[model samples]
Target: MPDPTPETSAGRSLLLVLHDVAPHTWPDYQPFVEAVDALGNIPITWLVVPDFHKRDSLAFAPGLRSMLDRRLQRGDELVLHGYYHADDSPPPRSVRDYFMRRIYTHEGEFYSLDQGVALERLHAGITLFQRFDWPLAGFVAPAWLMSEGTRQALRSLPLKYTSDPQYLYQLPQFTPISAPGLVCSARSAWRRGLSRLACELQAARLSQAPVIRLGLHPVDMRHGFTRRYWMCTLQQLLAQGRTPMTKSAWLSTRQAG
Candidate 1:
């Protein structure tokens, strides 16, 4: 594959995404959002779950709605993450499937969903987003895991884009924009160590890429070490000439140019 690195600062960008945003997770985001705001004017792309884990729905959270409205006004983009954000599929047929879907991530709502089910969830999420009058440009499957059926279902929508850890896909058309994501894991001590080291190395490796993606979760924000690492990483990226923007804003610029 050809490198998507650019030669000048004009084409460089840093896409900051906050994942697993729901009513219950909103509180954890406050401090992190403030910290990023203090750094500079950075627009966040929030992946909002309509009904997180099938337990809590956004319909009951007026405070979260208001806060999200404010975020939109501040240039942040709201994206439909998933309906339930949990894997309720039939048990995996293989051990590999079990580990990848159940063990590696229990939040793979769209991971194994068929086209019909994927469409149902996407529409359900869209309806909920419409209820709040939130504008959506993309739908990121939970844990960045989208089954092939999910891919097909997304084609039926008018969304602008969707992204996994690797390539950012232009919606409907599916033209891929090569932008590898830098993510952190705050699950356990060993996981944190490995994830931090991986992110550090990936950042160094993608030093000149046209776009650098930073995927942050609510748990990551709550952790002291992960929080500091993200803040410091952003500072370094900006110092090196990357302008921070929401994922949608970045796409607009890239497409416009």
Candidate 2:
């Protein structure tokens, strides 16, 4: 599909996303939230994992839920990330699968799921949101990985949108907005250095795109270097005339177009 034109004449739209948000990770996530809040509470799309690693579930995290509710009240968006943000399938067989499993650290929940399994998990996530009466913007698979079967299942579900590494997709109509994400990898010093450089290059390359997505993980904020890198990237983007936007608002603009 052709890339959508920039919505505003002044600058490109920026979508800030926080991924893998759950109770267990809240301690690590708090600093990022506070930092953003200090920056005028920029609109963030929180990709909340309903059941993180099958170890921490939202039902057991009242305090965290309350905090998230406060953020929602303050205009942050909440979206279903995955039912269990863990890889429970068999070991990877192909080279691509191996890279995803090994390099990505085994968090591809929807990578190998069939249509039925994907739909079942989707419904489970939806039910959890309904139980809390929280507004779910959409579903984003862990590590932005989804199988063909999972994609097929998503087509039949009542979701507003979903995103991959390179694009944000509005459901039903499936209009894609090209917005490559810049994320940090802080697993090790070597990885962090590489990620920093990669993210910088990515930001520079995608600076002129209609929409720019900056994805944040709790781990990314855990390291001093990565955290600094993220701040610098954010400031650079802002200086380039990018305006912060929520995922829902971005989608709405696309739908209106």
Candidate 3:
């Protein structure tokens, strides 16, 4: 296959990434995979948590590993999510921090980590992926939140990229890819409604962009509201000539140009 030319309209990339992927979340993710498969053998990215919340580790999940292996064989990409998808930071110092840490996001594993801690967690997550020999090219923090220290640590790693809610950063130099992600919120009825609306707006807004990102979560798959919404969103974007590709693949083409 020829490499995509990012400068052209035909090369606008659609990055559909599954978050919080682990053995414990496998069942929740099945519907999502099936839905995407319904659209043909479209490629997707799996943001895998090596040990979610420090409890559900991939080591004990042979079944999930088998499933992931098949996904990779079919062209899906695996990315290292935070080591322990749970946040271990101390109490927030202000109201703004509290809302971001405990309300807006339940857990931002890399949100407060300095370089030393971030590197340690990154190494631990990489070790788990290596144990299974899963090829990992990217690292995305849970909740799309990472500190400057985490960015500093990632610079020294061999990772291809990392992302926040608003941008995908190429590793080492951290070159910014300007595309805010579309994510679902199952926290409440209002949040869900608002999220769907925001998704539509973001999708339309990015119609001419070089890249468009859709971040799917376990909770989003379990609910019918978000599940159907995303499937339709996928259809709409595909109709607009969006070529779904893994984040690493997108970067490859971007650099190839």
Candidate 4:
């Protein structure tokens, strides 16, 4: 379980992360999950949003919980995404906050939260998962936008790890594992086209990294181009000798080294 060094040629680890899993989005996400499962032996990390957009909650969705339970039994990892994956705070104060709030899909739940609000949401999310008796592996803020206060709050949370777009961080130690992710933008034709190209380029560039992440959203599966690109990207990675693993497993292996 030694760390994957720069010269290690055994194979690169690829992490397939599905973001924004919730009762409302499960219908759209089900097929994507099946498609990835069909690949066989690939471990997926499902980022579950306990209260998505302040609407859907897992307590009321038995079917969704059942599906997630089955996934866990099948060796997939479940991690906290966000409590209410929607931004309800006051308007942004700084320029960075404005762009993050307005441009990052207006659902940056942890982007502007103070330590207290972030901790409150974190507790709520963890409680929901505890009710289901699901083992929590990590926390990933919505859109990977965590405020400085939220990041500080995470330091004290009893989670194994947390991630942003660029790195998977081992908690307490905060040792970063470089794992750049490639995600699609499927909101519009223009964005989809750009995202497809970006994903292709990023995959090629990060293929040599120790860990490469493929981030999928429910909306990405709805678009033909994005869906095809995702499949193609997976195939390309596999062809290059990348093996799929759960995020938690990857971190554990690295840490145990």
Choose the strongest candidate by TM-score. 1
> How well is each residue in 137-228 modelled by candidate 3, as lDDT tens digits?
89989887888899899999998888788777777887776656788887688989999988888777777788788888898877889889
lDDT tens per residue, model 1, 183-235: 98898878889999999999999998888989999888778889889889988
Clashes of each: 0, 0, 0, 0
Clashes of 3: 0
For all candidates in order, the CA lDDT equals: 0.87, 0.84, 0.84, 0.84
How far out, in Å, is residue 235 in model 4? 2.2
- lDDT by residue for model 2 over 126-180, one digit each (tens)? 9999999898868999988899888888899889888888877877555676667
Best by lDDT: 1
Q: What stretches of model 1 exceed 4 Å from their correct place?
A: 1-10
Q: How well does each candidate superpose onto the true structure, as a TM-score?
A: 0.94, 0.92, 0.92, 0.93
Model 4's TM-score against the true structure: 0.93
Candidate 2 C-alpha RMSD relative to the actual structure: 2.2
Question: Looking at candidate 2, what is the lDDT of residue 253?
Answer: 68
lDDT for model 3, please.
0.84
Cα deviation of 75, candidate 2, in Å: 0.8
Error of 4 at 84 (Å): 0.4
